[model samples]
Target chain A: MQHKMLYVLTISFFKSFYRNRVAFFFLLIFPLIFVGVFGIAFQFSDPLNSPIDIGIINNDEGVSNGVVILDPFQGKIVSAIRFSDRFISIIGNATYPNNTTKLFNVQEYNSSNLELAKSDLENRRILALVVIPNDFSIGFLAALRNIFADDPLLQNITKNWEGYPEPTFSTKIFIQGDQTLQQFSIASTALRQITEEFFSLGSSKVKGVTISTESELTTQGLTVFDYIFPGLVIFGILQTLSAITTLAMTDVESGLLRRIKITQASGSTYVASMILSQLILSLLQLPIMFLTGVMFGFPLSSRLWYGFVIAVILMFGITGIGFILAGIAKNSEAAIGLANIISVPMAFLAGSFFIVPNPELKWTAKLLGGNTIRVLDFLPATPAVRLMRTILLGQQSIKNSWFDLTLLSTLSGIYLIAGLMTYSKRHFQSQ
Target chain B: MHKIYSNGIHAVKGLSLEVEQGEVFGLLGPNGAGKTTTMNMMIGLLKPTKGKITIFGKSIMNNGKEIKQKIGVAPQEFSFYSHLTVYENAKLFATLYDVKNCERRIDELFNLFELDEIRHQRSDQLSGGQKRRLNLTLALLHDPDLLILDEPAAGMDPQSRAVLWSSVKSLVRSENKTIVLATHLMEVADKLSDRIVIIDHGKDLVIDAPEELKRKFGHGETIQIHVKGDLASDEFSLIKAKVKEIWPDVKNSNHSLQIHTDDAIDDLSKLLELLKQHDLKQKIADISLRSETLEDVFIKLTGRKLRE
Candidate 1:
């Protein structure tokens, strides 16, 4: 009974799904739009300037030390002032700078306008501000004299001096915020590097501390095209097949189907055939995209086979989800609306475009990372970067592979059950 | 077996009806009179809160698939996929019903309904009459033993209605199909149905053959005839006595007359002659007769006019 029913259901789904042009495009074309757009949007490899309009304010007026005791504000500040050109050129360069650019953006400010500048920084108009104190040179000299007094090598001058780099003259460079942990870490490291380079007594004298990040991404030499090819393919097949709210509503709308229902076709068998038809289309999607990506210079060679399985599962799962949602809605309009609602969120949150452990995590990221580690400790995709790094990079394993599978399966299960229940309930209510 | 159930709806109560093999049974009623609900139950689209239905000697509830194999329905309201061609729509339905030969069946239905010329036209583009023809055609395509139709001709033109009726009649003659037709059109029912069940407010009011029920419960009309000239109450009785010489027990009132009889037409002839013999200037001021028709019988039973 099951076998015969399944056979018929499979054929029915195939015939219905392939026959519709809209369903064809939804399955094969729509998802690639996301892939192409998001891929280009996040590419990060353009040699041209990034389109972010960041402002930098440097309020350091050149300071000269009178006492020369601490020698606090003399060297670095003087050096920066003398060569503001170079600092802006490298430091403020978001991309390959024009040949004429200086390292940083310097906005000279009156003491009165300083508060306004701070407000600007808070408003995100300016990325960072550099403030040089008014008695910078003299205060630094006094502090330096104190430091010399404590210095073992200058032990004889101890009674006459204060601390080194006079407190009032010490310069402060403020990046706008410590809002995100990654940014905060970069800022702190850069600051520490600045302090160290200046104090280093060795021959390898560095000009200033700068934060430069390098990313190493390898799709097993399979290239990004290969990775995307499979994802898009899976999306294609999943969307190709179709089912209404209930196996029975189709019967209700057409008297012929109802008659057939009374004839030999079993409901379960009919429904099963329909789902199987969709699965076939979904399965078709991955390979088509996969081959296209490979042909298009995408390096997707690493664990290439897994893409097929994953895509098929996700496709079937999403289709099931669509059915379930349709089942709950009063009509086709509601079903369409609900499917979009869930699909969009899953795409964004589940790393269909980008991998993120918790995209909502920002300044309090450290806390979330810890919590994420605790709550999502079992699933590899808990921290999205970790999962992508593993899958695309061919990392051996994640925290708990079984846990990842279990969580994903649970999610898929929810969509499936919900779809089935909704379909049944709504199908009956359609009268 | 097909069954529909609704709670808090005293729509159907112990309503046991059957259609023998190759018989046409009509369930007749006014609008909102549980006919649709009853048919829905029979189709298993609705689950009855109480009672049981066995079709072909098998339970319809929980065994709908088995019952569906033998039955077809043409619902009161017709809906189909608007985007599809007639052929496409037919084929899709055939597949949903798991027909073995979808293409062949589509051709068959298209030919049967005389829709072959517009087989490729989108269903939404079809005329109301054409769509209805399609509606009827789909029900017949499956070649089932039992068919159910609910208000099948409510909006159809007479020409289209004739087409539908002819096809239904042919189904009975050719396939020996058992049918349950629910309609309020007494004339249509009287013409096509072998037996009829009348219902109101979810309850069965009466069930019999059209002729039998009319004979059993019909209130034959009472005709009052008023002559132009003045006459006393006793004089009218004398007139009746003379009229009874030809037709007896013809009741009358002063300056008026009353008769309780089924044959209003023939009695009126004899009534006119009596006035002639009395040397009365026989000018019939008013003549009213209560004649029993199906409409009168329905009103008598349901307490509301059939058309209402």
Candidate 2:
């Protein structure tokens, strides 16, 4: 009988809300506008396609000795410039690249003029400038002596230079541009990787310590859209809780809440119907955002159901928050004011707008054995956003998200119980 | 029950009364006389600071659900959802009451209250009198054993007021339903209530039948004469001396003279004859004689009119 009453009330509230055009604007039109503005701004722009311009000042002076060189098979008079400017040897595509394509737009500066190169870098002509010292080739050959120690044929060529003082080679790489932190980080990292690869190749056959680099096929590169959409979806779900709070406060000010209390309807039934109605509205809200996101080319590596499951769990937590707001507020205006206070800061700090780097507050948040505090991990929206990112980006499966799901579920349960208790006491006992 | 509000203002103080079954008990007071506070306490909308209330042999605090099922309250304010149609509001209440045969019951109420034509209209769009009737109908939807109507005929036209009075009269006569009513309309209380309680400043001043109260505090007969011109003290004393010779009960204020008599039908002609002998009949603009009423009793007890 109680279930039947709750079901009836839920249906009635849905009908009432359906006819409320003002509610329609808040519940549906408002979020759609948010999605539209973001979609148009980000649809064609992928953050991974950041432009990187690097200048290489290759000043390596090579040796020209009249020594007979041996080809592998015919032993012909094939001469090779043994140690050349290897920094200039690296190549890159002029445009954005796929996995097999070069990673940068590399430019070679012939003159070692520091002032001219600095001017080009300052004028944004290059993201970074790399300078190879003049003794680069001599140092490169000396490092290879250990690798070729067993070969006598190679020993005679380098016998004249046996005690040659080893030159300390300095490869000064300057990162200069009006670039953001993320842009500067990406450019500097790429330049170091390319320079190290060439330096490693100079001592190719060294058997003692082998250094090899591999890029995994399973880890997909994330675009800015990939990083932000999960947070936006979670944000959209949590925002509906404020709308529900406003509706509940409206009921209170209208005296509908008191009138219903005077009836045979129990407080639990009223709260249950309200929560169920909000859940239904949230279910309606998620799809519009998901569809808009997909239209704007938000990548969907995992199936759609994974995002939906996370959304439902997040709705429970958000609805609990709505109940707490409803309990504390006296009217619709108060409810709206209180809801903004709770939601606005959480949205920003919990990574709804932009990622709050874990390192920024690492000492504070990571007080537990180099791990983020458990309470911070379950701060309503943080875990949901992270879990959605991992699942939708195909970085982690559902089985690996047990901790995140448990935290969200526990928060949902605790908040729901606390909200119900507080609301019941405030409304029933006070009245 | 007693009610001292959260602000420490004593709204109702140790006020207690028992309403008999099948009786239309009237609660009367001037504005701010704690009538609303008392009614809210009776219906469990407010918590009293002292004392307790028991309805149907069950405590209201612990047995609210059981008591609420037996009682239906129509608060003085407009409490129905204004966005819904009259029919929708009635249907909602019927559903809340869990009444069987809801549609037929609603149809019956619609016809009985003359609301059949406007049943589909939104409640806010209705005339004030129609809204009042609809409010009363909603309170009666569940056929509660105890119904509380607070100023039910307020903002109503005389015709609508009469219609509601007749319906309430029939409900008590036919169904023997107990009702607790609070109103400032003396005529309403005087005509409908089997017993009336007048409260002032959070205290009950008197509780008895309307006629009994009138007989106790009311002068027998009141004759008011509106004079055209003000009389001097000597002239007023001369008229008072002559009228007091027979009736002996008279007061003069402004240009009006009020005379209390045992029998207006017998003494009215003699009083007018004395004025004519003095050639004062030409100065009398109007003369009216009426039996003492509850309004007079209210003013006699509170030293002010009911609306004051």
Candidate 3:
């Protein structure tokens, strides 16, 4: 008899949910819309391969104090050389190795247009600005002579070098931009490496050191959208919170709960029916969101079964929150409002769209194992998102995500128990 | 049973009544008169503040789950899923009640309530009369021994109300199911109830069969005489003194005089002779008589109309 009640209630809830147009909109359409918009906006571009925009200001005066280099055909070639100009040329012509894509889209600037360049940097048109000092040539020559004086082979070349009287000319190359932006950090690092390369041209002892990267998985050509696809799928699953909350509240306000209370069916039977129905609906959301994501350049993986498991666990937690909301809210309108207030922020805090940095104000606990759990780990979405990204994008096996899976299951159990207790106390017990 | 709300309003105070097996018992009261509250307690939806309630010879407070299975309630509000069809709503309740052969039971209820024609339509799309019928149909789907209907014929036209009343009567006559009918409509109570308890301010004023209540508290009949013109102050006093001799209760208003007596037919000739002797026959325009009703009994007991 209990099983029969559960079956009928589950079917009835499922039918009522889908037949209501507003519930249908929230359950599937709203999250699908989010996927479509974010997919189109990202355009499947790789962030690492994108070029950085930078502005260069050359303010160096040419120095020609009898500096000469021996050419093979022309003997003792001597002329005024502007090292700042040469540095700017090297920056403008720099490109990735074996690729035609330029490293930086360099914008030239003069002393008068320096403010304009600064304004561009402020507006994010250019990620960084390079300001060459006026004594760049003198500083370069002096530094070269000093390096020659230390090496025996290059001491003869700089013994008769007559250029600057000072042993060192104080020169500063300023890289300016907003430090908070990621693009600014990349641009500054590249600029510093280029400066070191230019100074090492005259030294024979300096050796170029390059770091080569290799991927453990076959994720060589992945785009930004690939990393964001799993988050979007989890986002769709979270909307079930609002749908279930409003559905339960509708039952309470319509007095359907009271009607069912008079039946032989137990309170657990009704709650189980609700959870089972929403779990089925939440499972359907995973495939639909995955198919939509695949159409938008998201890479398909063979480990979709892992995602299914995570979706079920996450839904248990979400439905638990829905139960609590329905119990506390006075009516369906307030339930909807409270649902949005909880689910939207939870989605963001769980890093559904982008990665959230660790906050300073967090709590940590030590598990039975040697593992430590952070406050964010208590939220089921956190582990669900992590497991999805690892399994789907990283192409890792289920064994690699055991910790997250366990954490998610534990939190889901806690939420479900809490939800059942609150709902039963509020709606099932005698007033 | 006694019920005092958390806000200190005594919704039901020392209210006690008994319902026999296989009888239509009416609970009559005005608005805010604790009818729903009493029914709620009977079904274990509420716990009495200071009294005990037993259903099927078991304490409702301790054995609520066991007792509720034998009972059914049709609440004042429409309490089924509006998005589902009439048949689906019936099937859902039938399943919850664990009715044997669910499909056949639903079919029988549909036929009984005349809901077969609109069984496939969503409940929200049905008319007010159709919705009320569906509400009662779902409650009766389980074939409960004790069925509680709260204002079953409310918000219906005369034809629809008659159909619902006929269906309820059939349920009692054919199935012998005990019913606790709570309503403010005096006509419904008078026609359907085998016995009724009239309550006001959460206390019972009277409880008896309809005929017994009328014979005990009701004035037998009222005789109204409409006159052509208003009587002079002296003339009105003289007529009042003359009518008071026959029947002690005499009322005058709006160029009309009303006299309450044990029999209007027997008193009609005597009243006319008195008016004729007073030389007031020329002023008499019309005369009519009305028998006593349940509403008259309610007014006599509560000093207010049932709807007030």
**Which candidate ranks first by DockQ, i.e. highest?**
3
Model 1: CA > 4 A from native: A1-216, A219-263, A280-309, A351-410, A421-431, B1-7, B62-65, B77-112, B115-125, B215-293
Cα displacement (Å) at residue B9, model 2: 2.6
Candidate numbers sorted by lDDT from highest down: 3, 2, 1
Q: Runs in model 3 with CA error above 4 Å?
A: A44-220, A360-372, A395-398, B224-259, B266-288
Scored by lDDT, the top model is 3
User: What is the C-alpha lDDT profile of model 1 across A279-390, one tens digit per residue?
Assistant: 6765665565655554455455645565455555555456566666655565555566665555445444444444334422234447544332333322222223233334
Q: Mind giving the per-residue lDDT tens digits that candidate 2 earns over A1-431?
A: 77767886787677677677888777877777787678777666555564666676767664445433332223343344434343455535433445444456777777647777777765557756666556555455444444455678766765643643343333233434322223333555455455555545644542222122111112234456555677778878767877878766766777677667778878898889988988788778888888888877776544467888888987888778887888887767888888878877777767676655432244644554443433345567877876776677554567867767777788888888878887787786634
TM-score of chain A of each: 0.50, 0.62, 0.63
Ranking by TM-score: 3, 2, 1
Residues A1-431 of candidate 3: C-alpha lDDT, one tens digit per residue: 59989999999999988898887887878778888887887746654556789998888885776655322123334476777777787787777556777889999888889889977876677878888877776666665555454666444554565544354444667887643234554566567667767655645522222211111243545566776777777888887788888777877888889899998889999999999889878767777777778888877767766777788889999888888888888778998899888887787778777655533222333334554565576778987887887677654567756777888999999998888898899998887
DockQ of each: 0.12, 0.32, 0.60
Q: Order the candidate numbers by DockQ, best to worst.
A: 3, 2, 1
Where does candidate 2 stray beyond 4 Å? A46-228, A300-303, A357-371, A374-379, A393-396, B45-47, B224-262, B266-286, B290-293
B1-308 in candidate 3: lDDT tens per residue? 89998789999999999899999999999989999999999999888998888877889889987788778899888989999999899988988888888898888888988999999999989998899999998888878889999998888999999899899999899999899999998898999999999988899989999989988997888898777666576766677788888878787887778887787778999988988888877767788897778898999997889988
Candidates 1 and 2: which is better by TM-score? 2
> Could you say which candidate leads in TM-score?
3
Residue pairs clashing, model 2: none
Clashing pairs in 3: none
State the lDDT of candidate 2 residue by residue for B57-108, as single tens digits.
8888888888988888887777777767899888877777777888998888
TM-score of each: 0.59, 0.73, 0.74
